[model samples]
Target: MKTYQVGGSVRDELLGVEPHDKDWVVVGSSPEEMIEAGFRPIGKDFPVFLHPDTKEEYALARTERKSGKGYHGFKFYYDPSVTLEDDLLRRDLTINAIAKDSQGKLIDPFNGQDDLLNKKLRNVSNAFCEDPLRAIRLGRFLSYKHISDFSITPQLKAIVKKILDSGELNYLSSDRVFAEIDKAMQNHFPEKFFNFVVENKLDKPWLKDINSLDGFSASNSDLRWVELSCLNHFTDFDQIPLPSKIKKLISIAKQLANIEIDNILIENIDSLRILRNEEDIMRILSLGLECMDQNLITKIVLLYKDIKFAELEKLDPNERKNEKINLLKDLVSKL
Candidate 1:
């Protein structure tokens, strides 16, 4: 049996990025043999084990057959005679299919090294279509790597179009969709993810009339908070500021498109101070309010004060109308 370092660890090491995790492919090994060698079996659908000594994942060389649809519908086959070349051919991307030996000798059975040198993302084989998740994975890889130069191969695009046309994306859970998006957002160039979503028409089912918001591109988290803020009609003055309830408000404000109004509101530093919530402070700052706009800032503070006072009173007939007028006045002042 031969244990080889494989997958992202080898790919990332060549790219000069510290590898996040390590996976190994064990050739000529069986579950019973692994167990005899003191490895713990962990996978339910496939042959995977954990190295008793190193504690790293050690999966036997295997191939998969499509059983149904989406990510979960796959049947795996593990054979001790399957070579590393066979395992690499079954992978999604060329860059990911390459591996390294224990002594650091690189394996290039699929010419992944050439694609890596060209900074390209290419599929390993026609078997790429067996799973539909590759399209999302590729788009996310482009976003995370800030890769604009590389183009998806025609075959891959054809598969992606097929997947989109079939409306199988709706069958995918929101959690899985967000998981991919959240990972993409961790990259510094999150706008690329948004662009990918728009270009591939993936946003149609999830977001309504997304193109109507011109020049608005944001990470999934940013968009979520922004939508929440807008839905709440967040104002600077409330008994409890909405920003205090939402953690990502400042990030959302930064992602907003029509931010000229934010510029005007930020001039009032005192008003922001009185607000006392980080989200409120960010909102005021985003509106371009200055620290020394005494009159404007005082007006904003008074508005919040009145709103809070109205909420405190149980029997003030004009309180509701008065609060509305004050909030409107605050918005108009910023405009």
Candidate 2:
């Protein structure tokens, strides 16, 4: 059996970028053979094993044929006859289809090296359109390489359009869909991710609410993600799968943004409970302060810090609530 370093590790190395992880393609190997050779099986859907020493993944060379619908519809074929070139051809993008041997010799059966140098994201074959997840993955790659001169090939664009039009994306779960989106958000220019999804017409029901919002202008990274989360109403807020803390912050920020600045002093600010804990208050206040004046936010936050809720514990529970509201009103009046 021969092991060749494959996929992004090889592609990134060629572009002078440090690879984060190394994936190997083992030719002329079976699941039983890999296990006997000391590799531990890990893959649930395909023949993948982890190196006993290094713990890196090494997948048996395989080819896939579309058998049904969505991303999971493919049936994998792996055998001794499946060469490295056959396995490479099954890859989604040309730039990711290259492999490297033990001696560090590059394998470019599909001219992946050429595409990398030209900064082009091209598909290896028509089999690219078979998997719907590739479109989302490509969108994420676009965000990651936003600074680079790379652009998707027209062929791939048409394939993405076909996938989007087919409504295969609806079959994907919220976790799977957002995994790619969250990865893109971690990039330097995350806005490009939303742009790609919108521009490509990768439409889903929830996207309408998000697309309707004013484009991202927030400079703070957390606040930027907060703005994206706030687009949904309270009823649908939990559907987005955000952390509970983020949900609370987004809910609070949405309410804060809607409140008229002039009327905040006169109207009831009782909805905002006596937030005494500095960390919790700061987390919510930071997002809320995005739309309001910095001076006003500072005053409000300082007022929250100054009001000692521990002192209020001596009073009746009902009276304590009133006292908290009274203290907030008094502080707002001063501001």
Candidate 3:
């Protein structure tokens, strides 16, 4: 069997950036043969094996045919006859479809190397839109730190729009969908992700609630998530899957957002039972101070830090809450 390093690793290396992970495609290989050669089987949908020593994934060269409806309905065909070119055709972008041989020779069956040099992001084939997830993945790549400068070709945009029109977006798992957004949140320009989604009409029911920002440069990812979720008119916190902690922060952030700056000094901030932890609420407000430049938020957070929660523990829960609110109002009145 012949092994060739394929996918983003090859593309990234050509772009003069260090590859984060390497993926290999084995041509002229079978599951039985791979097992005999000491590779462990792991793939549920296709024939994928792990090297006993390196533990990196090595998938058999395969081709996909749309058997039913969406990308999930594809029937995979893997055998000794599938060529290296066949596997490349199944990739998302031309830049990602390049392969490097074991001898370190570049294989450009689809001219992905040229696309890489031009700093262009384009689809490998018309089949790129078949998988709705690529629209999200491409958006993530657009916001990637290294290749953020890459231009999305008009052809690529049309294909991605086809993905939006496919009506197969919901076919993807929520975890998979969130996984892309989470990665984009960590990228250099996360706002570009949302913009791209909106530009290509990729923002369907899943991301329709998010209002695209002109610019958002929040350093913290959770804070960034909070900012985006609150951009929606109704703030669809339950529409997307998020960790409980992030959901809590979004809930608190929304509360702070809805409150008029003049009305922050209330009897008890947790009157709605939403803002549970003072520390969490302050954290969200602190980010609000930086991102939104709400000077009132800074004063509220600073005044909160001065109030000693330990001293309030001596009183009952109701009394302690009232005392804390009284102390906050007293401090705000002094300012």
- TM-score ranking, best first: 2, 3, 1
Q: For candidate 2, lDDT tens digit of each residue in 1-335?
A: 99999998888888887888999999998999999999999998899999999999999999999998877898999998899999999998988999999998989999988888889999999988888888888877876653235888899999999998888887766677767777776766666767787788774643553463344555555556666755444334333466666666666665555555577843434564536334544555555445545455556667766867788999999999788778777877777
CA lDDT for candidate 3? 0.79
lDDT of 1: 0.64
Report, for every candidate in turn, its global Cα lDDT versus the true structure: 0.64, 0.75, 0.79
lDDT of 3 at 269: 40
Count clashing pairs, candidate 1: 11
Best by TM-score: 2
Q: What TM-score does each of the candidates earn? A: 0.68, 0.88, 0.86
Local accuracy of candidate 1 as per-residue lDDT tens digits, 1-335: 98788877888788887877799999998889999999999988888898898789999998888887777778888889888888888899888898888888888888888887888777888777766666677777775563545667677777778878877666665556656765665665555665666678876454332331122233344444453334334322222222343444543343232233446543232233344554453443344422223354445445555445445356366876566556656655643
102-181 per-residue lDDT for model 3 (tens digits): 78999988888888789889888888877888888899997787788899999988877777776888788777788898
